[model samples]
Target: MAKLALLVATFALAFLVVNASIYRSGHSSCERQIRQEDNLRHCQKYLEEECSDSPYNRPGRYLDSCCQQLENLERECRCEGLQHAVRQQLEEGEWEREEARELFQVAKTILRKCPNFEEPRRCEMQSRRWF
Candidate 1:
């Protein structure tokens, strides 16, 4: 379920770059959540393509990008952000739940690859694995 959460979170917060990550919307929390979810559905495919490193070290440095994208989040909020991105991507792609779990595991395995990555333990995605 890690990949699912990764994909979903990555796409869900496509707004990560669009200013929503730090957005102070006048809308209610519920409305904002819905909007984030919708954005995930609409943009997960592109985000995955741009944010993934699998299928041969993606060109855009998706992990670095993800790190940067999530950097501004509070410590506890980091995993939540990841989960949202993964979930969006997974949901949009119709991938299996197991993929999400594996992706999370894969992510943990490769954590050292991102020297500067600072995702806290909550982002461990221990409940999932990655390719």
Candidate 2:
């Protein structure tokens, strides 16, 4: 009986350690997701407020504001997050198909304009749906 109890206790302890590690890793990942979402929101807001209609029409001025918003973000994270965010917006009916397509184009253009921005292949594939 004592040996069985000891075994049970050992299993419980191991289980707890494993659970704690999993929870900690998940929590950190959640935090990172939230941060990326916030950054994407900020970038969208900046584009809406600062960029003129047909920003590609004036690449120089567009680059100034757009690059400022995007420069601080991790390039891969920013691209992936933006693609997800835009897809969510489309799914949620916040944007019409054409609007989402245009937005994706503008985002791609902005990323290209930003110095040292490495365009992620995933973003390209995801955003290519409209094209």
lDDT (Cα) of model 2: 0.57
**Cα RMSD for predicted model 1:** 16.2
| Prediction 1 global C-alpha lDDT | 0.50
Best by TM-score: 2
State the weakest 10-residue window (summed lDDT) of model 2: 50-59
- TM-score of each model, paired residue for residue: 0.44, 0.45
Residue lDDT tens for model 2, 9-48? 9999999999999988865664476464464554454344
Q: What TM-score does model 2 achieve against the real structure? A: 0.45
Per-residue CA lDDT of candidate 1, range 47-83, in tens? Answer: 4554454686444345554554444444454454555
- TM-score, candidate number 1: 0.44
Off by over 4 Å in 1: 1-60, 107-114, 117-131
The per-residue C-alpha lDDT of model 1 at residue 15 equals: 61
